[model samples]
Target chain A: MPEAAGVSADLSIFALFWQAHWVVKIVMTGLLACSVWVWAIAIEKFLLLQRTRTAMNRFEQAFWSGQSLEELYRSLSSRPNHSMAALFVAAMREWKRSFEGSTRSFAGLQMRIEKVMDVTISREVERLERRLLVLATVGSASPFVGLFGTVWGIMNSFQSIAASKNTSLAVVAPGIAEALFATAIGLVAAIPATIFYNKFSSEVNKQASRLEGFADEFSAILSRQIDERA
Target chain B: MRKALTISAVGHAVLILWGLVTFVVKPLEANTTESLPIDVISDSEFTQITAGMKTAKKVETPKPLVEKIGEQKPVEELTKIEKKPAIQTASAEPMPIPEPKKPEPKPEKAKAEPEKQAEPEKAKPAEAPPPDPALEAMKKAEEQKKVEDQKKVEDQKRKAEEQKKKAEEKKKAEEQKRKEEAQRNAFDPGKIAALLDKQSPRREAATGDTINQTASLGLASGRSATLTQSEIDALRAQIQACWNPPAGAVDGRELIVRVRLQLRQDGSLSVDPAVMNRGGHPQFQIAAEAALRAVRRCQPYRLPIAKYDVWKDVEVTFDPRDMFRG
Candidate 1:
């Protein structure tokens, strides 16, 4: 009857974490935090991108359905909204403000409307991409961080080996296991972050392009309207 | 941001809970403790060594264990037979109560019965059948002789069976004794010394000249004679863990390097370990330096501190042939 004595200590996840050297504990906790943050960012971005795309799609349908631009802008402007609606409201506001001057210099009105849409598009893009750097940083750095923890843990094991003056596998295996766990968690945090970071970033670029496309079409319509008004 | 944080926290919580429920360090299923290569002497054994005496007695096998059960069966059988007659006599009249007393005469009565039976067989017709007259006396005498002859054969058979049982018991006891002596001999210092001596030639073949040098150094202290083969192997394994052998050398296996280093009791090198073997072979110098680096990297070594006297000035040979072959 061997008591799994080759290496065993209530090797539950909690046990390994609890048994690790303090530096390794910190590394594991930090990596877990990074993983959690990555998932949080990914989830929020995923939902935000979906919502924005649906809003853009609905806006495009309404814009093509022969709905009056004035009526649509009036309906959308009252509600605090995002994406295409925000761009439309901003451009219409600038268009309306230009006319409110009584002496409408139609020459700059189209330019102002275009500038406002561009600003709104940029702001919306910034909001979509906010806090994405954390993911990138974690994806790139956590593995190295975990490796550091492992090295520190193995060093501690070696020190213990000398202190105890015993080289039996039993003596250092737990320490090494605990150390390697930090690397494992680090990879756990890193791989998903890396994969999602790539996916979400590409999605963000697609969203930005969609917003720009909407802005371009809206600006063209506004310039045509300005020409007819003049 | 809040939503993401909540989701992340929930995800981490689920992961931790799943890990908590599922992760278990199952010990290796096979027993690793059997005759382990134990490398240290305990404090009690340390005092014995200082006093120039043998260490604590090794654990011995429990002898005659099976024989104890074997020895008991016959007594139980004899008691069963003895109890049956006692029960029969008691049943006839409740007064005999020799259930307790019958064993005292059991031996004497058993011995007395055959002699008494022999005389009565011939004498009974001569003595008791006189009243029945001539015709019946001869016929009764013939009947008594036949019955007595049967009883004699039955008694002889029983005696033979018992003698066989006794011989079996003796053989079992002798086997038990021999086993105990073998166990004792295995623990004998002289036998161990002989076993160690037997290992040195193979060890010398394996490591070249390091073991002999360590052995001579140990003789001066009257401590251990040399690093045991297992200890040498352990050191070999430690150094090899860090060794990076040079590649691209033709027959790289032949470039064995020996490093002679002194260790402090703490298992660290006292000085830079020196490579003892060098040659004109192009790979020799590269392999030698790698060996020296490995020795430096693996230290402080995890040697048993109790045998530091023997291992302090030890030599280690790095043989890369196995690596090349493997």
Candidate 2:
């Protein structure tokens, strides 16, 4: 009388899990995976970018305070953590290699520095960009993937109705609902991936610019040291 | 780093809060499967049977009754012939002696053969003459006559019994009708009016005594508040029935309002402005005022219609806390 027993009319657990067709289940699973992946990238990139920015700031301060190249290399190599400093050491080593073979002139030094700086910029860009393509792929493609699942799910729902000869809302609503969930998950997966991708890329570009600026300044210091030695 | 952590913490908190809200207020009891079954067959079964019969008839040939009868044997033929005579006798008209004579002749023929066979040796040729045939025919006629006469006597008796039964039923119905009519006529309008008038004063006196007793009791109880308990209860019931609290009254607000009033003999209320206390909420003040207005509009209140002293001056408190707290 209080509507406690037969009145419950709960959707069975099997029905809840199997409400979506197999295709929809797959799509939702994929969307869920994508969402998790995006969140991981967002968090990982946040940490990586934070670390790089902090390290770059410290390295720039040390470099500008007139520490010798050898001393700076030794200190930075000991830590082996700063991405910007690593790039600097690589470029400086290459410049030193190119200078070792050449008659050491202003023109040769200038050319070597320019080439080293370009290579360093490219290497730093690569280091900053690890696994970023995956983020972009997820951001750009997840919505369409979710849309595909939704459309496929809806189609299957209609097909089921045709097979069962039932056209009622109860017969068709569950499948459609499951399909729409895929699209909602897709958007959930896409939005943050796109946001973090943009944010990390910008931060990487900022770090690259800082590294390039530091290279030019370091090259000027090197030229001054050479002139003072002469 | 600290700012980022704080922002993340706030974001997680909001997301968790929304998730909890969604869970708590989820549409758990939706009637999604409240639809009729797909394969309803009872209504279709009749149609299907009818259609099946129609198709069977279209495909099958009809059989003749004569052919069906010929399929049965010699015993069935004799039984049918015997039953035909009985049926003819039962239904034959008295005026139509021709049909009855036909069956009587057949019986005579059969009797003659049986008589000849049984009494051959003792038969007197001259004595077994015309009288014998005539006597036998007369006896058969007399037997039929006796059966007809008995049936007539039975019919007459049945008619007489039926008439007696009908007469008794009619008499009973008339008696019942008279009793109902008498009952309807028993309540005289003038007497009823006099009785009602007689009870009114007694009711008023009893009510007045009750009021006086309650008022004295209230005074003696030593808590001589501005209103009596009976009056408070009545006013509370009235206001409770009248007040519809405003929609979306926020949670965690103490929404109690107390209104004191002066009542005239006619049950009209003049709210005591000095005694009206509006608890802190501004909305509570407005709601209390509205409730008071509702009470005034619902006047002249039907207070224990006979008693005035109990409800002469009353204080009513309106508390919306219970209604809106959840």
Candidate 3:
């Protein structure tokens, strides 16, 4: 009776531990870690884009508020944290240099300003788009990678059961749970990544449009001032 | 910027809270104590305490001796008093005390006279007992009886052992004799050859005479021999008995062995030895040769005594495949 009791007790504990299955435990742990990482990236990207948008909007308003260019530049020059402010400073410097040229023409001045603005826009867009490609890759490919892992793990589980000659529910349930866990993790990683990628792309587009609009407006304002001076 | 700060702060707060909950909560739940019923206690402290109590009880109880004898008895009398309770009780009752006290002083007087008498008795026995022939004879008779009884017992034991050994030896000898007789009676090649030789020549001579008679009657010119059907059947059966094919020969191959023999004037097999001819599979050639050797070993063949001429120049065709097919 004691020997039987010992076996039964040990079997119960073993069953408890085996309930999760080794493969399921591994898959669940990976899913949990991936979920945490995705959430962190989403939160960080959300905050960064929000801050950049706000700063661009504030700097644009300050630039177009009927203040003298010299005064506005002087005020914004100290704050390099603003991306659009940096673009404005670079364009303004190039515009001033062209105005002081020996044979400076209106067309030449406009061309120089356009060139500077184009260069600044490209640089700012590059900075905003950093790490977005990696997000897209993770969004598109994570499900397949998790699928591969699930498939391999299930294959191994079936092989083990075949060798052991057991097909009971207790033996089969854990492997199935582990396979499902991998799929769940893949979805968890992919959904947010896909959503955030789309969101970030749209945000970047809006910011690009704002930048182009500001550049056009700034060009018109500068041309009016030059005509008055001439 | 403020919105971004708020979002970052909330994220850090959730992560830290979850980490703390995971690390601290589950361990506490797992470690909570559960009550269990006590069955048989195995603690040593209780056993030790019980043993000490029993020892204390033993020490507290009064001894039987102390209960019987007064505890205040004088130390000088204690040893004498402890030896025997009956004697002590008798002495303690104060009867016969006067006689015992008088006799104790007179023993020294009595002891000296006994020693004088004892020395004389010891010396007289040594001097007087030597002349007593009856005693000496009695002592000799006792010793002789002891020796004779020992000899009788030893003779009986030796005789029983000899009888047992003789029976074992007789059994072994009978077994050995039986084994030797069985060996002598068993079949031997020399005896068989001698028996065959003695009978074969006479039979062969008669067969030659019959063969010659049949040939003179023109039996060889006919399709069948001049011998009757019964005689032919008997010869076929005898030859069949003599032939034994070698083991493991191919069953598909056909083999034929022809033997030609000559007869002598006395009607025994004589001048030209038997010749063999083989046909069919080359693999069967080895088997055919072995079969021919067996036939030669069985020759001068036994035959009907009256059929000498018909059998003498006999040509027998040995076909093993036909025999094997059935």
Which of the numbered candidates is closest to the native, going by highest TM-score? 1
Error of 2 at A53 (Å): 0.4
Cα lDDT for residue B17, model 1?
95
Off by over 4 Å in 3: A1-37, A100-107, B1-326
* Candidate 2, B1-326: lDDT as tens digits: 34544555566456646755553322234333434445444422322121122223332312111111122222332343321322222221323434433234456677776766576555657455434556678899879878887897899899999999999999999999999999977878777766564443431122111112111211222222224457567667766666676555645265665665555555665332223564676576677766666666666565664345446555566666665542
User: How many pairs of residues in model 1 come into backbone collision?
Assistant: 2
Tens-place lDDT per residue, model 1, B147-224, is: 987898999999999999999999999999999989877666656666664443431121221122111211223332
True contacts kept of each: 0.59, 0.03, 0.01
For model 2, the stretches where C-alpha displacement exceeds 4 angstroms are: A1-17, A94-107, A163-166, A227-230, B1-326
Candidate of highest lDDT = 1
Per-residue lDDT of A1-230 in model 2, one digit per residue for the tens? Answer: 23222222223323433577787778877876677666666676788788888888888888778778778876766656766787678756655664676565555666676677778678768977877887899999999999998898889878987986655555566667667767877898899889889989888888888878777777777777656755
Worst 10 residues of 3 chain A by lDDT: A4-13
Cα error, residue B302 of model 1, in Å, equals 30
Which whole-number lDDT from 0 to 100 does residue B89 have in model 1?
21
lDDT of 3: 0.60
Worst 10 residues of 3 chain B by lDDT: B207-216
lDDT of 3 at B259: 61
Q: What is the lDDT of residue B259 in candidate 2?
A: 61
What does candidate 3's lDDT look like per residue over B1-326, in tens digits?
34544554577458646745553321111221223434453332222111222222333312111112223313243343322322212121323323322223246646754765567676765664323445567779879977987998899999999999999999999999999989887888778866564544431122111122111221222222235557656654555676776555546355666665544323334433344564677656666665566555555555665556466566666666756764
Model 1 misplacement above 4 A:
A1-8, B28-326
Which of 1 and 3 is ahead in DockQ? Answer: 1
